[model samples]
Target: MVDAHRTFVIVGGGLAGAKAAETLRAEGFSGRVILLGDERDHPYERPPLSKGYLSGKEDRDSVFVHETAWYAGADIELHLGQPVTSLDREARAVQLGDGTVVHYDKLLLATGAEPRRLHVPGTDLAGVHHLRRLAHADRLRNVLAALGRDNGHLVIAGAGWIGLEVAAAARGYGAEVTVMEPEPTPLHQVVGPELGQIFTDLHSDHGVRFHFGVRLTEIIGQDGLVLAVRTDDGEEHPAHDVLAAIGAAPRTALAETSGLAMAPRADGGGIAVDASLRTSDPHIFAAGDVANVDHPLLGARLRVEHWANALNSGPAAARAMLGQEVSYDRVPYFFSDQYDLGLEYSGWAPPGSYDQVVIRGDAGKREFIAFWLKDRRVLAGMNVNVWDVTETVQGLIRSGRQIDPDALADPSVPLETLS
Candidate 1:
């Protein structure tokens, strides 16, 4: 009972696009569904690329979002390795790279972000790498294994999540790793200096050398292979490979060219969308890392690049596209696994957004729950080596209730009671 007249087209072949297509069917939308992707591989999740896959604990097959036959069985017309070259907003169509133009009644852009490249010299060397895509991870995996076996060195630029994760993986493989960052501490922007020190200590304990308050200026290579990297401080570190783990920028070129409203760069630029995930054009919607949402509860526009955002936002956008009332007010959530430590973070509390950081349990032992509060209200929380309190932590944020700092910092006080 599929409707042939109305067509729903999804661009990008990541988790967001794949989940949206699945949700459309689950919601009983029997229209023609077309999904376009630039990569030849089927839709897949990204968390494993940095964690299990890179660490040699998971196989490649575990990354795919669904079996190859699932798309065909779902009646989802998937065009892989064909990128959308241009968007025709007026015609309500998009032209593929191979020159095929497909019209849509409703369009969803789940196009994700790309890793920001290091513009330093010798970046074109053979051993320099970036890890935003599966291809990159595949190559880096081999490189890390080789470097580990040979006792080679890896110099990483920017001690962000990607860098630290890779550093941990390399250490597990017995490779010498050094991280260079312009910030004074690791994850300075996300967790702030107060919590960043925890990561600094963690990585340090694992033999990962960190160069803080310094920028990577150049990569010295010999015959197209990385040899070492030089920093602004005039120190050179021997390196068999260099990884640029700086950050990622949203893919907004197509949206901008189609004349869609864009968020300001200051607000983390992307396609501007309201709470319903609707863009300026009613027929078009956006989700995932490419969409900057004007969040209702946060009262701020946010563009989250984490796996959880993609997992939730895609289905939310699918419902919105089906003419269902939708409010995507889910607090941003993400988790990281490093060595023997695992942590889950919920809600948003970028530095300057909170006034105090209250910790329960022992930070020195790396088993604690840290709450970032502003005006006695929990803005965000992170649980390290702590189990199954994500629900209670998110509840505190959603409740927006003023909390007693002493109670929040006491392990004896249950978070459920506070909310």
Candidate 2:
């Protein structure tokens, strides 16, 4: 019942790759499906790595996308712990690290992204960590536990989501936490200053120290173990561990070397693809964090590194691979849990994109919905401690309707009536 002639090869066995393979089978494609991954573990989600898993609230088994046996049962050829060395675009094949060549009729690149490393010295030293992988989380979880027990200090770089979440987790473990950020406010580029102060207040109220407008200059260590970190401002803070949570850069080495088209660095660089997720080569396609897609709804080329993008784009790419008309236009979405404050943000409204930010409900009590509007059109929305309104928020973004700021801000007026 299998068609050996039509083989679909998926590179990078993360959630996107796994979901793409699953989608292929679910869509009745009974051909040869091969998945390759660099890590030994099965495909898993990355969000838990910084949230529940890092905090010791979730077990290791909870991270995997599917059971080990599911791959074989679904007739998916899975190669774990082996990374693809190079892509032969002309030959329609990929070379493995061990010099093995695997030919494919269609190729899907779900290579994902890697954590941006700090350029400062002492990064290679012991107790300096980055939280991008499961292994990294495992190590950081234990380090946090130990630091908590010893009443040690954690020096985190960057005030992004990962940095803020880790700061909260470190505090929960009873470890002293301090965050260093080059930006004036936390998540300045994402939510802008209007709401960045909310997160700053949230973390500060939990006793987390913040050093803004400074970059890490050096990391001082004793016996190769981090002792403290020095900032560009010439301030040295005692640190038992250092976490670089700056950001992630899309893994595009293979795509670049293979001569596939790439998006410009100014446009959030990644492998460039159209709405169908098709690359420069028709035989090859891309999805997830690695693919910079020309979004139909947003009318712009965008690269999203959030969990939702990976969750949805994988299947969309698979459908496209199967020769289906695919238009990936899902509104970008991401959620964060920092202490008692939990928020879900939908749509895209980076700095300079929106003209106004309207808030509904109480900001003092930490319960509010903030909407970013451009030309009176809802561009994005963030609901803090608000429940069951994701559909409405996303609907407003999708509709692209000009909404009254007063009605949008009033809790008395139902959001559904705005549309």
lDDT of each: 0.95, 0.95
lDDT of 1 by residue, 289-370 (tens): 9999999999999999999999999999999999999999999999999999999999999878999999999999999999
Q: What lDDT tens digits, residue by residue, belong to model 2 across residues 2-53?
A: 7897999999999999999999999999999999999989999999999999
Residue pairs with backbone atoms closer than 3 Å in model 2 (clashes): none
List residue ranges in candidate 1 displaced over 4 A: none
What are the models' TM-scores? Answer: 0.99, 0.99
Question: What would you estimate as the lDDT of candidate 1?
Answer: 0.95
Error of 1 at 37 (Å): 0.6
Q: Residue pairs in steric clash, candidate 1?
A: none
Model 2 accuracy (lDDT, Cα)? 0.95
lDDT value, residue 21 of candidate 2: 98
Q: What local lDDT does model 1 show for residue 323?
A: 95
